[model samples]
Target: MRNHKYLFLFTIFFFLLGFMNIHFSLFGIVCMTLPIILVLKDRKKTWCQNYCPRASLYTTCGKSKKWSSHKTPRFFIKGNMKWIMLAYFGISLTIILMSTLGVARGVKLPMEYLRFLIVIPLPFDMPQLFDIMNIAPWLTHLSYRFYSMMMTTTFLGLILAMVYKPRTWCTICPIATVSDVILKK
Candidate 1:
């Protein structure tokens, strides 16, 4: 707790900022990218160990013997699940990019249909929020889709943390996995 207190505070600040405006949602990008940056700086897994808001919160909640019931499943810790998750993310990103570009090119795509797959809706309509802020509609749509993706990933991570080890999801996190891979090269 002592080691992670500052990260916990920053996480709260980021969450509040996210609710206040769509632009602040770029914090998600920073969170996703930081692992890789740390790896490049030769501080591999620093974000997961010391800085990730979600990981820190999970540790506080589940680190105690009473809270953590089961050992993380072998498959989750040592099997192909991480690659599967990464592939899912890849497919989702491809769909989002294609859908956004389709909209930009005046080709109608059913974006609402994709949104239905998101486990949780964002707190606000990001496109509408951007409109109120006088930002471009296309960029708003892109950001909205990205935020939806982030929400889905966060929800999945929460479920995994509750069911398994505190940092079970971190083991298979795309960013963390990629960072480790890159740093091993």
Candidate 2:
């Protein structure tokens, strides 16, 4: 891990690898899943504080903005927004799984492109990088969906960091919400 000297590389690989072989996007699933597992076992935000590569990227990028010293907005810090984000995360994950299952069972659900908020498809296109392999189409679909979800969250985090403060997006991060609810941290 380069003794953690280059943490953003962890985050960048998911985005870049998918361009070469979309199946590499499946790594997003492990990143998505690990925080929950760590929180459940340790009852801590160790993942958010230390292991999250996107947080690393956001912090480095946000600090570069210089004008990002503004207070985090009330909507991101107060009330139900964090819970709402968690709900959106949950729903999007469910849709990804169910859609994959449908395709595995021979249903012809449309493959996801780069989605913005999980439901809204964005205009960017990806090569069908998995077509050369004989794997089931659902694997490729799942890979793309996971990549889109990761990108969507990373984009939101970067925007929040730019407009307010470095790591400000952590206030409403879905996994942070989960940790707070579970560990009261």
Candidate 3:
């Protein structure tokens, strides 16, 4: 079994990936992030190292054992991971902002449906339940909104991984795939 810390971070990220908007209600985010907060006093790579699927996939891709030591020219660290993260996040955020604004202005772009699909909840039926309950509409709206952000971010991250390192996000991802694999081996 993995440590609680791993579960803690993964739960939050999974929750965000699945349900980010719920704006007016902190219930979901709170319920999800609580464990991470509790474990913050003794933070570790418990989450990223053992339980994350993304990390597992990357590890399966067969990286060089010394890949982390391969330094980029302008970096202080021996690894090129930092630059990859920076580029991915920067481009992702920029694209999200521009795409969102364009959508609001009725402009068309490729993968525009993804913008809607990402922000919207998965299973496609739960948000409507909130509407039936007459709960906060912002919660439903925000859930959809944040997902758009995450999709853009994750997509950009994936693209940057191709250009930079093989698994840049997995390197610092707060999930537990790595730790579990090492222990099991």
Candidate 4:
């Protein structure tokens, strides 16, 4: 079950679709929700071992046997970093929801600057891309917020994969940590 070659390939396929302007939200939604559902159903970190795309990617590309044989720092895996990251995720989600609702009500917030920071290096502005696809403006706004949140988490995963254990980020991942807690109960 640990070999996730198919999941790794699927992740690459999705990235290509994303580059072609597809939304690909269903995959993200599934990734976010399935771990919790599995934990509730079977009380295990099944997703991390057999299903997470990022974990698959790390296993395939992170050269963990060669580059990360050292024990991960205790703090990186079992310290305050996880809580801090979870707090950031919670706050970011709250702000994104509030900002999206504000857009629906024709209210403007200074969220654009923050959104811009989040979207850097992407070839197109998210709302405008959605506009081109004839999607509802409110949906566009929500999509941008979701993308921002995903990118933030991905960046953290990349950093963890580079410096610590290939799957170290999984230890502090909000979804994984939450699932672990729920499964323990």
For all the candidates, what are their Cα RMSDs to the real structure? Answer: 3.6, 2.7, 10.4, 3.6
Clashes of each: 0, 0, 22, 0
Give me the runs in candidate 4 sitting further than 4 Å from their true place. 1-3, 64-71, 109-134
Per-residue lDDT tens digits for candidate 3, residues 36-80, read 543453355443434544444333332434444233234423455
Using Cα atoms with residue i matched to residue i, what is each candidate's TM-score against the true structure?
0.78, 0.89, 0.40, 0.80
> Which of the predicted structures, 1 or 2, would earn the higher TM-score when compared with the native?
2
Per-residue C-alpha lDDT of model 2 across residues 68-154, encoded as one tens digit per residue: 377777888887889888999999999989999988888766485778887788877886544446867898788888888888889
lDDT scores of the candidates, listed in order? 0.66, 0.81, 0.42, 0.66
Worst 10 residues of 1 by lDDT: 122-131
Write down the RMSD of candidate 1 (Cα, Å).
3.6
Which candidate has the highest TM-score of all?
2
Better of 1 and 3 by TM-score: 1
Q: Please give the lDDT score at residue 6 for candidate 3.
A: 33
Instruction: Give the per-residue Cα lDDT of candidate 1 at 100.
Output: 72
Candidate 2 accuracy as TM-score: 0.89
The 10-residue segment of model 3 with minimum total lDDT is 172-181
Between prediction 2 and prediction 4, which has the larger TM-score?
Answer: 2
Lowest summed lDDT window (length 10), candidate 2: 1-10
